[model samples]
Target: MKDGQEYLLFLTPEQDGLFGTRGVTFGKVPLNTEELEVSEDQIESSHTHTEKLRTIFNEGRKKYGK
Candidate 1:
């Protein structure tokens, strides 16, 4: 993700109870259309590893982006 940009992230805690943002690049999604920078584009363009997140993003956009 880029600095200062908002994202819809899927976070989970490790065995130590500390949250990990490690999959930001693979599962996280940008919150705004304007925030679809290179990384975000890359994410949408390739869904081999992120089909669920992509589906969520699409459903959200269709439902909320009126």
Candidate 2:
């Protein structure tokens, strides 16, 4: 996805959570674009991870206050 373009990302099982204003770099994975399928389920999952990240960061800020 292009920068400044809104996008939802579903992290793999290994990923902890979503990115707030920060960005992430994924490993290079070759795939067939023709078989790509994006669904509401994936979007929701991404949203969930984003929320989780937000919560975690909030808690950290509370603790550090810096």
Candidate 3:
């Protein structure tokens, strides 16, 4: 991918508090036409993850009142 180009990533959380790609061979999909077309399920999963993350963040903010 080009240096400035954006990409879509599908990741799973790791035990060490880091995220890694869902699969070793399925990492770093570009946000281009063909990639997007082939990744409908992944796109949906990304959206779900986004919502879950938002919820987690909001709960943390409330708990800490930060």
Candidate 4:
């Protein structure tokens, strides 16, 4: 992930400094494309509405203590 670039990361629990289990991977992507400093190998898809995603993510983080 790039510094100050907002990225949504879908990560599994870390093991030995790596996320996910064997043969599995997740994505970390920023919605805003204006400052895209780099690209990722895999990017997960989501609903296009940014506000809705914010609500969901915020609520989840609050409730789940992540």
Candidate 5:
């Protein structure tokens, strides 16, 4: 997803990563910020949001003791 271009992610109730066997993969995105309007700060912010999601998943794992 681009920094400025908005998008929506839909997650089903059963698809919750919490307490599940599903594995989460964090991919490495290679982008050239010079060609786009997106800035390094904006990209960092987006990654921070994903970090929060990872934190949530970690918490869920702890809670479920999975």
Candidate 6:
């Protein structure tokens, strides 16, 4: 990678280190594309946005512990 280049990473937690979705080949993708595709969708949530975030954080704390 060059000095100023940026990339998007898809990673999974590992005991040794984070690994890509499918080994090194699927690790990262360059974000320097001329045209990038984006899509937006709306979904219903049981909790308010802040409450949803708090719920997520609480779940993480349960998994990894505080």
Number of the predicted model whose lDDT against the real structure is largest: 1
Model 1 has an lDDT value of: 0.58
Question: Between prediction 1 and prediction 4, which has the larger TM-score?
Answer: 1
How accurate locally is residue 8 in candidate 5, as Cα lDDT from 0 to 100?
24
Over 1-66, each residue of candidate 2 has an lDDT whose tens digit, in order, gives 434433333344444664332324221111222112333453355767656545544454445333
Which is better, 1 or 4, measured by lDDT? 1
> Which stretches of candidate 5 lie above 4 Å from their native place?
1-45
Q: Give the whole-model CA lDDT for all candidates, comma-separated.
A: 0.58, 0.37, 0.50, 0.44, 0.38, 0.42
- RMSD of each candidate? 5.2, 13.2, 10.0, 7.2, 12.6, 11.3
On a 0 to 100 scale, what is the lDDT of residue 24 in model 3? Answer: 38
**Model 6 per-residue lDDT tens digits across residues 1-66:** 346855455568877786644334223344554222121222234347445544543444445442
- Each model's TM-score, in the order given? 0.46, 0.32, 0.40, 0.33, 0.31, 0.36
Best of the two (1, 5) by TM-score = 1
Write down the lDDT that model 6 would get: 0.42
**lDDT (10s digit) by residue, model 3, range 1-66:** 447755455589999899987753244454432322233454345767556544543443344432
Better of 3 and 4 by TM-score: 3
When 4 and 5 are scored with lDDT, the better candidate is 4
Give the runs in model 1 whose Cα sits over 4 Å from its true position: 22-26, 34-53, 60-66
Candidate 5 positional error at 46, Å: 0.8
Badly placed stretches (over 4 Å) of model 4 are 16-26, 34-66
lDDT of 2: 0.37
Residue 50 lDDT in model 6? 40
RMSD after Cα superposition, model 6 = 11.3
On a 0 to 100 scale, what is the lDDT of residue 7 in model 2? 32
**Quick one: ranking by lDDT, best first?**
1, 3, 4, 6, 5, 2
Model 1, residue 10: C-alpha shift (Å): 0.8
